[model samples]
Target: MTTLTTKLIQQSDARGSALAVISDDLSLTWRELCDFSLRCSTMLRDKGIEKGDRVALLCSNRPAFLVAWFGLANIGAVTVSLNTGLVGEGLRYSVTQCSAKAVMIERAILDAKRADLEPVLEGRTVIVFDGEQDLFAVLSGLAADAPYEGLGSDPLSIIYTSGTTGLPKGVLNCHEAFLASGRWMSRYLKITEADRIMVFLPLFHTNPQMYAVMSALEVGCTLVIRPKFSVSNFFDDARRFDCTMFTYVGTVLSMLTSRIKTPDRNHKLTRCVGGGCPAEVWRAMQERFGIDPHELYGMTEVGGWVTGNSAENYRFGSCGKARPDVDVQVFDPQDNPVPAGTPGEIVVRPKAPFTILLGYWDNPKATWESSRNFWFHTGDAGTLDQDGYLYFLGRLKEIIRRGGENISPFEIETALLDHPDIADAAVVAVPDPIFGEEIKAVVVAKRDFPPQDVRHFLEGRVAQFMLPRYVQFVDEIPRTETQKIQRRQLQENDRGMIDLQGVEEHA
Candidate 1:
């Protein structure tokens, strides 16, 4: 089996002279990157980490993170990436859940920000990269060319799910599966050495890390890393790096369009790819930015993207066709495949060269539950168009039932996002006296805009009952570390804040 280590070798052979990764002030050729990763791998080994061990990494998006990822994999170690944004019990839960053997974190996060997490690091060895007490000072200088033992089929990385429903579940991605997903992306995305990819999303997420980072490395493409997304300076950074493409989420697209400064699309960037872009947002963004944008549907549990819109056959409001060697079907509650244009649960079956996850780490029941009927059930609702374009509706569990009427939060949230004053919106079901459940919207309005403005805008667009009965304005929508809006968290908050009175009168 060809492992990710082999992929790096292939890229190095194909374009040894080409730049593989770029940061604000650094650039690494394929050979140099391999050398760095090898040295880092040896350093990790000297620290008692070996093949099949779980090493938790908590740091910002930097060259070191990528080095650690592939370096650990080089020696057959499984990397567990924790979201540094997580605080208190939530962060601690992820550390304990993974049963991590060692943790490497940035001291700024441990010492300055959340000192409480230090207790969890009491027994475990802590390596604070680039801190006052630097980890490298204690260790001997390691050689770059460490013997690479091929550990194919062994676990390479364990990504924790965003925990939309509950506690985050660790999804194990083996070396074979990780490479398979990367190859599929490289072939489908048409990545090449000439391409300079911009990655603003966190590497902890599957889409950006796999599609943006791994796909580029697989094809010898240059990766221009952004520590995080910044709407104000995104275009400037893209221009500086001469980036040909970038990965995005729906929130990033919305933030770009909300800005007064429009981006020029004539140079460099051909397209931006990611998932959850609303139809209207796409149109407005294309007009404002002059760049064609594509959407992809993926989950961490599945390694990477299962479907994506590409240049050859682009479709609006669709997450593209099923990937090669992957089967995507919309199944009913009974596991029967529904015809095109009917909404159902999305499920996937892997073919040759596509690595399906072995199981959820330490959760056999969930692993079985997600893989029923020889298919991996992706808990998401989608409908396939006649052209085989998959249109994501919403999460199956997130569906709101009011007075026996089922409502999709995606529909209502999209409607609210269309309002000019509304910066962001999330719809969730709240407990109601008579209806059993009612629609409540949490909104983040643009500066100088009021909640009444949003309510008035939605008055004519949707049915009276479909309107949000209660609207709470927040400074920002709470997002997972991946920038995915946590609608479930909003629902929990609405339980305490929503007002029961004042239903919209029928027009």
Candidate 2:
């Protein structure tokens, strides 16, 4: 039930001499990290940051990010981790959404986002951290003090969603929820002090925040931080850090498999974890690297693993079984639990306390809407097998209803990704006069080719009804930081497409 700050102090006291973090050539021992974090806390307190204050943290993936984050939490200030990739309204909305008092941004980020940020942070305290020197010099002349005592359920972070269509909601998460997820990750992945957890994912996301940061502290292991995911240097970085475990964002595995890099089987890396990977990519990684990429289903709201695949218990093409302490069920439109293998909205409820989010920041209506029939509706569509294995079916809103049948874009996208000539693809529903909605496929191809070829390619592979009605070629498909397709952007994009069949492929 201890908070992240308390755990940091405990790790500092017990293993002060142990290496805790490594970012490039520099490294931090437990003691130094704790001392710097304490200094950061003292400095922030002096800057008028008080308990219950929400501070926007805009920074890159570095040790300083952790220091500032822990420092803020130490003083009971909520860390509003904004996505660095967000720009304009998406960026401004995140900062002002929770009435954040200060915007602690990296100088580089501030310089780049000055236009989008300048007006919003006019009166707000804009604390900027450029690099290690700034982080180290924080509370420079002030004495280090113990962290403020707080309950495990105290708000620690407010993670905002990627608002593509609408303003992103700030997810209010507490210490226990974050740590519990970390403990589960540590145990499920079989992490130990000897294992180095490599975090190449964005720090703003749940995987790195909960799995990498919290798991490393829970097990007193070293955290190997990278600025970003690099295809060429991934294995090299792993071997250099002696990292035994690494986490991915579903797309990393695909990227690694797609690239024609030299055989990288000889590394300390073993366990790979995260979700969004197709079965082909999952198997490709296993066959090529001998590491099973465990598929774990989670999000900003749940703050923990709703379903996961591990070595002991796993199912190919499924996002594992519901976590032992979490009740994951699929419910129909009427709010009744659907039978196994029936596609419906994935709803979750924690059997254990402090595992789910406190609420969607200040949006009680959104929270209440999510908590329908005592089960938190995830808004994503999925199904549970008879054995309780969960199969993801994309977002419920993204499910296209042509005539009466609901078609999932994920399966079509996964199929499209298998095309050799096609580099990337996304499926969306277009307005149709007859069928109500028609399936449209937007593709990024290696070379120009007839759009009908795509339909011919999927002839027998997918259901006839699942074949896309329109095929559009695009220069690139926009994706989120985690590499998820930006479906909304595609829906808003004007049509420069070829209609495949003038009729729906209804049997």
Candidate 3:
């Protein structure tokens, strides 16, 4: 029955002047945070926004975004968090797709997309966070207290997916689902009120919003916010903000590991919880920073994490066992459970009601398709061991098919990453006349390593058929905001590729 407003109010009363949120130039205590959210809610209500109305927030990782989010929750309105990096048609589509009644945005963002946003802003309330029409001024004129009477089933937020494959789908999450996710993550990460967490991932993402922001709020912990992840200033920020815990994705971890070690690398960080930590980089990062790495597995549609590795029970390269409240299984194309140590699609079923996503916003077809056969199909390929640990493979669609054999790109990518010279690698499927699709590896290396050396390195490790037929060196690999590889982009940019085995070109 607990709602975000009730939880925040209770935490404010309990924690009072305790630090709640910290950014580069701004910090707020629990009481202050609650007051700001109340004012924001009042402002929204004053602008004719009613309960269940959609309010779009297009700000970066700052206090303004948090205030807007909680404000929407307080009024029982749905918060549509748009990506700050999105512009033009993408930005317009997101705002319109959700039918947002109002939009609270930074003035800088508005100015940048004034032409595109003008058409979308018609008949909607637009409040700028900066300049002459500052949103803070409106809040300052309003009272600093409001009441919330919302059910746990009330819709809280609509978080859009990365849209790598096509247009982003808005994932609708209810209050109960959001709260349950935070509670689960807090337990998984062993988060406490005394902990201070660093959150540098974009707020538009579910990882930072659900795991870092919500977990901290649920436990009355302090959240140190950064605009975005910066490898150069990560350690410094963690130390400066006295962060005891932080979350990361694989790409950020790789970038951090590639950076030269400095004397100021020491920090108060004790725990790191995130997904996509490569097995090779896990131990090296822990040894270098003295922080425990806890890998997890989940998607935006799952509400939160379905599986996670903990300090008490952790296995290298495994995403840990399925959470007790969730039924996670690997299923074949026919929806039958696969045997242990076999790769298949990962599916999940929630044991508790309202603990997973309500559905895709305004897209019943997608919702029904994902929840077919009474289970949520994740579209990811992975294997479950006899010990119940889940090992994540690449996406099912991304799996490379060679001469009548199914090949996992993740397996080959992991092998390539094990090489000392390679920093990051992505294996993609390229068109082949005979094999249908062949393997093309796009790599980012620390130094110049000949393609022949890469082939030799993979000779004894992977099967001859699984080795990439073509290799291309790039300065950087293209990735989405969430750090997932953009294999489609690599395929589109594969003009000049080095053939390792003198493979014939496809017609």
Best by lDDT: 2
Separately for all candidates shown, the number of backbone clashes (residues 3 or more apart, or on different chains) is 0, 0, 0
Could you give candidate 1's per-residue lDDT for residues 160-198 as a string of tens digits? 888666788889988777776667776766777788999
TM-score of every candidate: 0.92, 0.96, 0.95
- Angstrom error at residue 10, model 2: 2.0
lDDT of 3 at 249: 77
**Full-model lDDT for every candidate:** 0.78, 0.86, 0.85
Per-residue lDDT of candidate 2, residues 178-203 (tens digit): 88887777777788888898888889
Q: Residue 350 of candidate 3: its Cα lDDT? A: 93
Root-mean-square deviation per candidate: 2.9, 2.3, 2.5
In candidate 2, where is summed lDDT lowest over 10 consecutive residues?
498-507
Stretches of candidate 1 exceeding 4 Å from the true structure? 131-140, 145-147, 261-263, 447-456, 459-465, 494-507
**lDDT string, candidate 3, 237-286, tens digits:** 88889999888875777677667343344788988888888776687677
How far off is model 1, as Cα RMSD?
Answer: 2.9
Q: CA shift at 484, candidate 2, in angstroms? A: 2.9
Model 3's alpha-carbon lDDT is 0.85
Residue-level lDDT for 70 in candidate 3: 89
